[model samples]
Target: MNRAAHLLLFAALALPLAACSKVTADNYSRLKPGMAYEDVRGILGKPDKCSDLLAARSCTWGDDKSYISVTFVGDQAVLFQSENIR
Candidate 1:
C-alpha cells in the first residue's frame, strides 16, 4: 500500500473510535431539555440502542456499567441521565 492509502485507512478507523470517546459526563451535561434529536445525536454520535413508542423516543449510549440515556417526546428532549460515566 502507498503512503496516502495507509493514512486514509488509519483515519477511517480512528474516526469511529474518536466518536465513541465522545461519551463523557461533559457531553452528557451538554444535553438539555427541548434540544432536537439531531442536536443530541451530533453531541453523542450514534446511540447504542433506541426505541420508539408513539411520539416518545428513548436512546441510550454505552452499556450496563456506564451509559447515557435521553428521553424525547415529540422531537424534543424531555429528560436525560447518565450512569458511571467519567
Candidate 2:
C-alpha cells in the first residue's frame, strides 16, 4: 500500500479506540460521596442517561452488561454502583 493509504488505515483503526469510554475501575474508585455532578462528568465525560425525581438525580454510563450508575441528591452524589467495569 501507498503511504497515504497506510496513514488513512491507521487513523480509521485508531479512532474508535481513542473514543472508548473512561468507565474503568480506576475512575470508579476516584468517585466519592458528595461529589458534584460536574466533578463526575469531568471524569466520565457524560452519562448515557439521566433521570430526575424530586431532588434526586440518577445517572448511568455505559451499557447494561458493563455500566456505572450514580445517585445524586441536590447535585451531590450520595451513592454509586457499577457492573462489569474493568
Candidate 3:
C-alpha cells in the first residue's frame, strides 16, 4: 500500500482504542434510585464533604467528581441525583 493509504488505515484502527477510556452514563448505571445511602457510598467511595440535617432525613454528598445528594428515610433512599462535575 502507498504511504497515505497506510496512514489512513492506521488512524482508523486506532480510533476505537482511543475512545475506550471515556466515562459514560453506563459507569453509574448500576446505582438505582431507592438504594440505601451505604450502598451508594460503597459504589461511589467517600465523598469530599457530607452534611446531615436532623429534621430532614437526608444527606448531601459533594464529591470532587460528582454530586450525589440522597434523601434517606429508615435506610431507604427516597430521592437521588448524580451528575458529573468534570
Candidate 4:
C-alpha cells in the first residue's frame, strides 16, 4: 500500500476508538431521580446489559475498571449505583 493509503487506513481505524466514550463519575452525576431513560441513554450511550421487569427496568454500564447501574420505574430513573470493579 502507498503511504497515503496507509495513513488513511490508520485514521479510519483510529476514528472509531476515539469516538467511544467511557462511563465515568461525570456521567453518573448527570443522572437524577426521575430522569427519563432516553435522557440517560443520551448521556451514557447504551448500557452493556438491561433487564426488564414487571414494574421496573435496570440498566448496567461498565468495564473491568468501573461500573454504573441504574434502575428505572416506569420510564424514569428511581435508583442508581456506581462502583469500581476490582
Candidate 5:
C-alpha cells in the first residue's frame, strides 16, 4: 500500500480504539466541573466501579496504565482526579 493509504487506514482503525479507551488524559480532559453525570458517561463510558456517599456519588474508571475518579452531587460532577498516567 502507498504511504498515504497506510496512514489513512491506521487513523481509521486507531480512532475507534481511542473512542473505546477507558478514562485517560485524553478522555479525562473532556470532563468538567458541573457537567452532568450522563454527559460524563457519554465521554468516558461506564465507570469500572461506583458507589454512593452521604453527600455525593463517586465513580471511577481506569486501567493499569491510568485511573480517574469523579465525585457527583445530585446529577452534576463536582470534582475529578486522574492518576498514574503512562
Candidate 6:
C-alpha cells in the first residue's frame, strides 16, 4: 500500500511536467533576431508599443515589463534586443 501511494505521488508530480506546452504558434521563444518585422508581427500580433529601435530606420515592440527591440536595415530586422524591467 505504501509503495502504491509513492508511485501515485510520483505520477502526480510528473503529470504537470508532462503537460508542459510543446512548441506552437504562441510560443515566442522560437523567435529569431533577423526575422522581418512583418513576419514577427504576424506571429506576435499587435504589440503594446511601436517606436524607433536604434535610429529612424529601425522599429521596436515593447511593454511595461518586457521589450523586443528590432532594428531594420533595408527589409529585415538587422539588429534586435530583448529587455526585461525587473
Evaluate all candidate structures by whole-model CA lDDT and list the values in order.
0.92, 0.95, 0.62, 0.88, 0.85, 0.59
Candidate that beats the other on lDDT, 1 or 4, i.e. the better one: 1
Best by lDDT: 2
Measured with C-alpha atoms, the lDDT of residue 69 in candidate 3 is 59
Higher-TM-score candidate of 2 and 3 = 2
Ranking by TM-score: 2, 1, 4, 5, 3, 6
Instruction: Give the per-residue lDDT of model 1 (tens digit) for 1-86.
Output: 99999999999999997665777989988999999999999999899999999999999999888999999999999988889999
Those runs of model 1 whose alpha carbons end farther than 4 Å from true positions after fitting are: 1-20
For model 5, state the Cα shift of residue 83 in Å. Answer: 0.7
RMSD of each: 3.5, 2.8, 8.6, 3.4, 5.8, 9.6
Candidate ranking (lDDT, best to worst)? 2, 1, 4, 5, 3, 6
lDDT per residue (tens digit) for residues 1-86 in model 6: 69999999999999998655322333356567677777867765555556563543554455544666556655566666566622
Off by over 4 Å in 2: 1-7, 10-19
Write down the TM-score of every candidate: 0.77, 0.82, 0.47, 0.76, 0.69, 0.46
Residue pairs with backbone atoms closer than 3 Å in model 1 (clashes): none
Please, what are the lDDT tens digits per residue for candidate 4 over residues 1-86? 99999999999999999766657788888899999999999988889999999989999988646788999999999999988732
- Name model 6 segments beyond 4 Å from true: 1-28, 52-56
Which of candidates 3 and 4 reaches a greater lDDT?
Answer: 4
Instruction: Report the lDDT tens digits of candidate 2 across residue range 1-86.
Output: 99999999999999999878789999999999999999999999889999999999999999889999999998999999999999
lDDT of 3 by residue, 8-67 (tens): 999999999865532334535656767877786776555445556663465544444655
Looking at model 1, how many pairs of residues clash? 0
TM-score: model 5 vs. ground truth: 0.69
lDDT of 5 at 42: 92
> Ten consecutive residues with minimal summed lDDT in candidate 2?
17-26
Q: Cα lDDT of model 6 overall?
A: 0.59
Model 5 lDDT tens row, 1-76: 9999999999999998877666667788888999998999998888888999887999988864578888999889
